[model samples]
Target chain A: MVEEKEQIRIGIAEGAILATPGTLMTAGLGSCVGLVIYDDSRLLAGMVHIMLPESPHGRPSHPQKYADTGIAWLYETLMEHGASHAHLRAKYAGGSQMFQALQMEALRIGERNVRAVSMQLERLRIPVLGADVGGNVGRTVWFELPSRHYLIRTARGDERQM
Target chain B: MRRLQVDPVTLDALREFGNIGAGHAATALSTLLGGRVKMSVTDARLCPFSEIVDVVGGGETIVAAVFIRIFGTISGNMFVLMSLPSADRLLERLLERLLPAPRKAQEYTELEQSAIAEVGNILSGAYVAAISDLCGISLNQSIPAVAIDMAAALLDIGLMMSGDEENQAILISTSLVHDGNNIDAYFFLLPDLDGTEVLLDILRGKIRHG
Candidate 1:
């Protein structure tokens, strides 16, 4: 009997980390950041689907909903799973201006989310290897643990690897 | 992320408002297609933000979505979403008004996209106008934005319009079906937490004054 590669699904405002011989996937990223971090040497990858830049009103009940907390949580989780912090590299997609008709700054949540995620990663000294973001489209993201590559597919059926 | 639980009274008020709004929207849609359009408010409630993805058939359900951002005394988002097949049916009926013998199956063209946006604009306007008249409060809406994508992706755009801390959405969902359910569509009106509270307070005030 042969075992199949396991694929774990991460929903919005959630985070997950997986080691080699598996896949981590998240779908429908719009005005949200799908942050993926990997430690090549350790063959460990983590993904966080962050919905907002910050939790301003009060203490956030879900850590994965905010970029700051979510990225921090993902970083810590990877470390706990034997991933070396020094070998961590990041990539992300999403933060699109979905409502191109709306010119208000408030509607630019996608851009804000990307900026927040970047800032948080920088604070942890993690370098972002690549990103496919912005524009007026949504994307689905997947991280392959074996190759440590990121796959981003747009709503228009355009796919890119980073 | 403490989920806000709206009081039952507020939920009832929102449902009533949604019923009236959905009726106007359906009438507007019927007028557009020059055909009888039946829209039903199946359920209206304050839903946890986390579960909306599942309600709309998960993250990858291909859908046509129209968004209208509302501002003024209260601010939120209004959306019209349907499966691609449903959108195709609606678009065909809509385009037939401008063209003779429109094809039933094909990729959506730029002209069809514009027509869909216009239809969405009219329907959303009717819905918002009804709410404004009932509440006696002014509401301003943005030009309609259209997209074809996964339901979760499209819904994320609406969720972003709400405040970041909002954990719950007043999901006033309406379904429009055609020809014994060959075409099925969903309409959603989501008001942010603060906006929901304000709307309920205004309704309470109106009731007391009346």
Candidate 2:
């Protein structure tokens, strides 16, 4: 049995694509979407901590911050790393409402982010295998590349695997 | 990346602004808890959005928070954060009057959550009132949104208020203490780039005149 103890943790507005054996983790996804693209056969996994749906005003300094650009960038990066788009599968978690009282449509960023991520995946012709989204909670996700599974842990200590 | 030009004069002015706001917020919090409260403006600067998660410990630090979005001349985001233990202490102090039994549960009850949100509402009201007076700006707050989650998650919402990741934001961080317990509280005020620019101009004008 191989002991896999290492993991890569990515921060806000960050993305990581790892071919390594360990798990890839991203923490504190409230309205943000933890979009993971995995090539099961090649053991290549990528995660982008996307905060906003789109770059409305202009291109951001960090391409990984917006769903539109970040998803595209992650797709291209994964493809360049010897992963075929045909073999890529998408999984996402987070994008909880988090704040209920703020009724402004703009403040409903979580719903928008989820929609944007799904749209981008559809545009790329990628199938979304699983998702855990839309609630007034926060989540942290850990993706294991070797097994191609994602474990989501909520702030309330509830755990879900996808 | 666009550099947010906040000169020394502007920084000093912002520090003064934060000091006055924190003073009022401290008093409001003190009145609620029936204890002495002290708040100090530690730093006021235009910082990168990515650094916000690191401000209140690391990204995954579990925290209780109240978030309010400002909409007006000083449009931005305001939030108060404290560790779960500190939050429990606050709930214990508040629930005595708010609840009949005043029992501490492993998880926060709805009333306990409301109490925490009310505390945040009061403190943010005081802070905004001071800023409106000093900057002479008409600022309105959205409804208070409360949550107990990871520090990183809350910070992400605060950063979202800024919109553009490339632009710099005004970060006014305050250290708060109550009854000598040294409650690990963080009061963050983040203004968008345009709002920050307007704020710097107002500060410059104030400094130049006075």
Candidate 3:
């Protein structure tokens, strides 16, 4: 008989890191982006759920709430915890346009968040292995560190592995 | 933006605002459905942005939500939420037929979606009219948008419009009950900090003059 691993749930504007024998997940992500970076060989992974694209005025009380700052924080934290910088890979999900009628530029927060996260990952030299983004629906995502399986579940009850 | 100090008097006034608005909404719903509708002001207070999902159930709780953006004298977001079962019941009443249980929101037909949106439009219109009359302010609303998804996903729009600096929101929560049908619906009014201050100022002025 095998034991079920522990699961850590990340809330809005929050992040978590897990090693082997654990899973990290975030739920009900609408316009928000759920980003995961992991070192497959080391079995270490970190995830951040970001709400906005950029943090105004440089730094805010909660850096994890923004894409640029949150990605940077996650990268540094993972590196500090013995994850190899060269071996780090990324996969992300969420960032959906929940309301399709508005059409205002400011209301396109979902699209903007996805662009910001992608740019940051590129600047940091982290390759994006998979992504599920830019739609008119919400998503929930889970990442298993040991198996390195990234699962995305859409609001319509469709589940796919990235 | 600085956090607006919500005094006890302001909280009470907000509750009263919710009560009157919800009362009008219930009447409008009752007339539309041709049934007795009862309303209750469940909770009106300052809630952290992170905990807003918990108010509905949880982050992952499936729900049917209608969103309307408020404009003019006071600007913010308003939402009408219902559990899937409650939404199904409401749909049955609106469409005049029994529907098979839906496994997910995507299973709803186009006609059903529009029906739900129309309900949101009527209820929010009535609620806003009551508030406008009470405050003596002009307000307008955008066309309602419907989303049947996780409660947190549907609510993120409200938090985004409320501004990133502000972590807490003044939530005026209300519930509607349809007599003889057991349909339960929730209403949330999330006004921005600036909007709240303006609303409170007008309310205080009316109190002083009276």
Candidate 4:
């Protein structure tokens, strides 16, 4: 794993990152929220690309695709690599209205997912240090290890430390 | 009941519309990648939101990459989906980099998500704009967001169909043409037939009045 010097691209219906020192980077988030959680102490970080805000009432498929499930998975995975609540910090980015034809409940998937991720983070008390959430701008987020900073880049070339 | 009807005329219009939009997206993509790679536009399908399960899912819930949004008072869910190979190819082309296929995949990195979101933004933005221009309707596009997972999560049919005959859904299954693999883009139009017809009327008015 140490010699794995490679950059991975996470596509639609996908997510990827390198938490081990220099093996991590990714982006392209819209409507779907991207959550970057890392344990600085352990030098571990994970990027979660979620589409929907919640799991369906009856069943949940593609646990990695929903904020509720992906956040939990990220927490578990991060903690497995030596992360604690105190050392655990989460940053959020993306959640936009790309489609201009749906309103009310039908068109609020972005807001809904952001709310859900926020709630889950609160429940875990992980202390979300920053967020660039809820807007009509598609974003690209990068979780750099060692520095443990979440770099946010939007579609319109807006970059910031979120 | 009366979900989206992909009649021959409407189907051709939608396909042409998708083609124009996807072409614009390809232009943006080419500039970003420094390569002239294009995503060809394909056919269109109209689904009754309720049947999205089979449309988006099979034995295993396929990965559904979605860009969620709202335009005016309509529910605009832009979805990109395919089997695993389809997803990989799209990502590879978009990244213009070497992305390892972790045998067991977990999460999308922020860059990857953003890049994909960028892809969604380009395509959807061009799409909505074309629709608005052709239909002569105004649309306020939100930023592009993305999620990857099973087809169900991508489509979220449950929410669309939770109501009775009144608040149903009309899904427009549109395909884009490309070399490597087939990628399907779902334009899950709002369920209310009334709005769609009104929208069509607006489109008609554009050609008629203009």
Best by DockQ: 3
Q: How well docked is model 3, in DockQ terms?
A: 0.67
Please report, in order, the local distance difference test score of every candidate based on alpha carbons: 0.76, 0.80, 0.83, 0.59
lDDT measured at residue B204 in model 4 versus the true structure, 0 to 100: 45
Q: Which lDDT tens digits does candidate 1 get at residues A51-153?
A: 8898764556678889988887888898889988889999999888765666777778898998899898889999999988888777888999688889998
lDDT of 1 by residue, B1-210 (tens): 565556766666767766787788778877776778787887777676567667678777667778888888877887876667666777667665434332322245767767767867876787688678668888898888877666787788667556554556656666775444445555566776576666667765554455
lDDT of 3 at A48: 96
Deviation from native of the Cα of residue B48 in model 1, angstroms? 2.6
Per-model TM-score versus the true fold: 0.84, 0.88, 0.91, 0.49
TM-score of 2: 0.88
B90-139: candidate 3 lDDT, tens digit per residue: 88887779989865788988788888888888777876886786788888
Give the DockQ (C-alpha) for candidate 4.
0.03
Question: Candidate 4 A-chain TM?
Answer: 0.85
Interface RMSD of each: 3.7, 2.9, 1.0, 10.1
Ten-residue region with minimum lDDT total, candidate 4 chain A = A5-14
Writing each residue's lDDT as its tens digit, candidate 4 over A94-125 gives: 66654333454656777887888899999988
Tell the DockQ for candidate 1.
0.48
Q: What is the lDDT of candidate 2?
A: 0.80
Q: Which ten residues in a row have the lowest lDDT in candidate 1 chain B?
A: B97-106
Tens-place lDDT digits, model 4, residues B172-210: 444444444455555444423255555554544554455
Report the poorest 10 consecutive residues by lDDT, candidate 4 chain B: B157-166
Query: Per-prediction count of colliding residue pairs?
Result: 2, 0, 0, 45
List the DockQ of the predictions in order.
0.48, 0.57, 0.67, 0.03
Query: Any runs in candidate 3 off by more than 4 Å, and if so which?
Result: A1-4, B1-8, B177-179, B204-209
